[model samples]
Target: MKVGLKLNEQFTVSKHNIVQVTTFENEFHLALTNSEYLVISKDDKDNSYYYTHEFNGCLIEVPVNEYHRIQRELTEYFGVEIQDVSSDETKDQEQPEPTA
Candidate 1:
């Protein structure tokens, strides 16, 4: 399963499958497939959230100013990686496995 994401102007738009989620202290670690991971943390002072995604040893911080929107999305997507058609090509693509 995978989850498609298009966060505003952020160019990190793509589908990701989360293999594991670990919380340590105030930050959370989300290990995704394809050599990627995300570390998310919340700022209680302003009730905002911040995160950084790493791929191939490179990490980029994603700035999200909308607290509620992001929070809602995170809650909705967390533990919710599902197959999604993020693009037209994927919509028409065939499944990898053939069912009986």
Candidate 2:
């Protein structure tokens, strides 16, 4: 399928309700809002790298190299900071504090 057609399908089913699509650094970036975006690109070798972002709930399929390239571009362009959260952090927050 053509890249445009693939992007259309992604927009139709995206949970974030993609409102715009643009190209940056030769990759497609689908925007749901100013703070939320999804990047898509075609893999040069396998053409089957697919994954979903847990936070934004966006689906993406692209070449491994393109994935990293676009990720960096998105971060830089949007000034987004990607943080790693441990499961322990969530567990600690879920527990009630001890009463005095």
Candidate 3:
């Protein structure tokens, strides 16, 4: 996930601009001007599709294959790790207590 990025670099993720790289879903989400979201779709063929979504956009499509890579890039660029929700935590929260 470490891509050797510096925090002071212009490419660094900031409050106004963020490079949302979704690794598990292999997609890139760019938050553009207000009400605009740019999504980059990655496929097995290495084909990259660009999409623009407005505030009223109905649906968002994120390619599954490029998710992992996207996440890695985001982490590298932001110098942070994406916290994953553990299955054990989910089970613990969902299961009811047994009677003593």
Q: Rate the local accuracy (lDDT) of all candidates.
A: 0.46, 0.50, 0.44
lDDT of 3 by residue, 34-89 (tens): 64544444444343233334233222343443445445555566678743334676
Q: What TM-score would you give candidate 2 relative to the actual structure?
A: 0.30
Against the hidden reference, what TM-scores do the models get? 0.37, 0.30, 0.34
* Each model's backbone clash number: 1, 0, 7
Model 1 bad stretches (over 4 Å): 1-3, 13-16, 41-68, 78-100
Q: After TM-score superposition, what is the CA distance of residue 76 in candidate 2 from its true location, in Å?
A: 30
Pairwise TM-score winner, candidates 2 and 3? 3
> What would the TM-score be for candidate 3 when compared with the true structure?
0.34
Compare the candidates by lDDT and give the number of the best one: 2
lDDT for 2 in candidate 3 is 43
lDDT-wise, the better of 1 and 3 is 1
RMSD of each: 15.5, 12.7, 9.1
Q: List the residue pairs that clash in candidate 1.
A: 2-82
CA displacement after TM-score superposition, residue 51 of candidate 2 (Å) = 12
The 10 consecutive residues of candidate 3 with the worst lDDT sum are 4-13
